[model samples]
Target: MRAALYFTPSRDSDLTLAAAEWLGRDPFTGESVVSDVSGSDGLVDAPRRYGFHGTLKAPFALADGKSLEQLEQAAAEFAASRCRFTVPELALGRLGSFFALVPARPCDALNAFAGDVVRHFEPFRAPLSDKDLERRRKSRLSPRQDALLCEWGYPYVFEEFRFHMTLTGSVPAEQFDDVEELLKTSFAAFTGKPLPIDALAVFVETEPGAAFQVQSRHLLVSAETEE
Candidate 1:
């Protein structure tokens, strides 16, 4: 099994429902949703398997001497030690050939938070398999990214990380504008608002090719009270 740290809204939140509907899968309920957007099922085919989430730590199997219980405990401790905050705004944007919701401006706090997660749980992460490494290298990464991949098992971490809730897979250049507009319309209710980074979720993929599902959510405790 592989585990990932992700950012997802509370199970009952309106944002969760809306994003689930848009993506055609609800990680919370493990139910399939019929999307209203034309050709949305095809567009979201890749991301749907992972559900609606922004990756904090990319998925990896547990390392030798690691157990699921230990991972959960570590995640809870990590969450409790952190402070909650919100991103000022989010907007629909295209990243290369994919569409996603991205922060409208840079957030130092968010970057630090994500970087911390990547580092904290790394000890429990198993080394990437040769096949996985090869697949990542196929993307034609820069020297720095290749080095990060060798160290972190993922290319995008630390300075290279860009927080995005992927909404589609690789899209044809010709279809980009139409897809972007469709997503904008579909997600109008949730975009351009303060997005809370109040919780961290642990997602698990039980086996290869299985859809990832939320195993637990850990709330970020307020720093003021801790002090």
Candidate 2:
């Protein structure tokens, strides 16, 4: 089974339903938008076999063939030292060829949370093979981008970062605008007030038949007090 860590909204966050709805539409409507833009013939969710959210850790195979309990224990330890974050207001945004709800205000807290998650659990990951490198090469990078990719698997990190609730798969050059517009129209309700990124939830995909459920989430708290 493959395991990944993700940040999910707390129940208190009003954007949860909106995020879920956008994800639901992504498989169907989003597939078309991405297909129209990129000319890539594919389903948006075959690999994920699921919808979307911000990826804290890209999916990796479970190490040592470890049991879920062991992985959970590792994550629990990591969460203990981390303080909770109150994610600020976010606005819908367009990335290279996709759309997401990006944090509208400054959120150093969220960035630290992401870096911490990567640092603490990095031991669980094995280096990416040639095959993985080739697959991720579709997007070209600038020197700065390359540096970020060397440090973080993705080119956008820290200040160069923008949090997005992913809405589609990689899009082709042609259809970007259409997909962005579709998402903007569909998810406008979620932008009313800044949505709090108040928790981190673990959603696991074990096998073909398994469903990724919200197994657990840790709450974010003010730095002055313990969470």
Candidate 3:
């Protein structure tokens, strides 16, 4: 089974609650948008899998047949020492070909946490196969992006990263503006007021093709409120 450590919103934060509302507004919001984008949606009214959450680490298969307990222990140990930092107010924004809500300010704390996740979870990543290499080559990678893929087994890490809470599956080019507007309007209900992010959540994928489920959450040191 493949597993990933992700950035989930706090249970009590305004943004977290808002995200749940968005997901409830549309089941598609609570699923792996990447998968839907990669496949054909021929089925009618299919319930989607997974939901809105920022990715701290991309998915990777367990190495050397590791046990889940071992991975959990490692995660708990790593999480215990880490305190959460406040995520500044972010708004709905566009990411390359997709749209998501991203941090408004460039945040070092976010990058630091992402680095920690990579370092902590490096032991579990299976070695990249030839197929993986081919897939990555097709990606339009910058120097830093290539470096991150080589070192971390995924692109968009460290200096080449931005934090995003995904809102929907792949939107076609024509519906792009409409979807963006819709998501923005939905978010608008939460943005004018304070929308704080203050926790890291762990979401677990149930099966090979299944969506992920929230297994646990961690609290961070709450940042002093910004005026």
Model 2 ranges with Cα > 4 A deviation: 11-14, 25-50, 143-160, 170-182, 207-213, 221-227
Candidate 2 residue-wise lDDT, 106-211, digit = tens: 6787887776776666677656656756666666777786676666565665666666666567777677766667666766776655665555566676674454
Model number with the top TM-score: 1
| Candidate 1 pairs with clashing backbones | none
1-227 in candidate 1: lDDT tens per residue?
99999999899998888888888899987889876768675778889899789999999999999988889899999999999989999888889899988999998888999999999999999999999999999999999999999999999999999999999999988888888888888889878988889899999999998999999999998767667
lDDT of 3 at 86: 57
How many Å off is the CA of 208 in candidate 1? 0.4
lDDT of residue 16 for candidate 3: 56
Query: For each candidate, what is the lDDT?
Result: 0.90, 0.60, 0.65
In angstroms, give how far residue 103 of model 3 lies from its true place: 0.4
C-alpha positional error of residue 95 in candidate 1 after TM-score superposition, expressed in Å = 0.2
Candidate 1 at residue 110, lDDT?
89
Candidate 3 residues lying further than 4 Å off, grouped into runs, are 11-14, 24-48, 192-197, 221-227
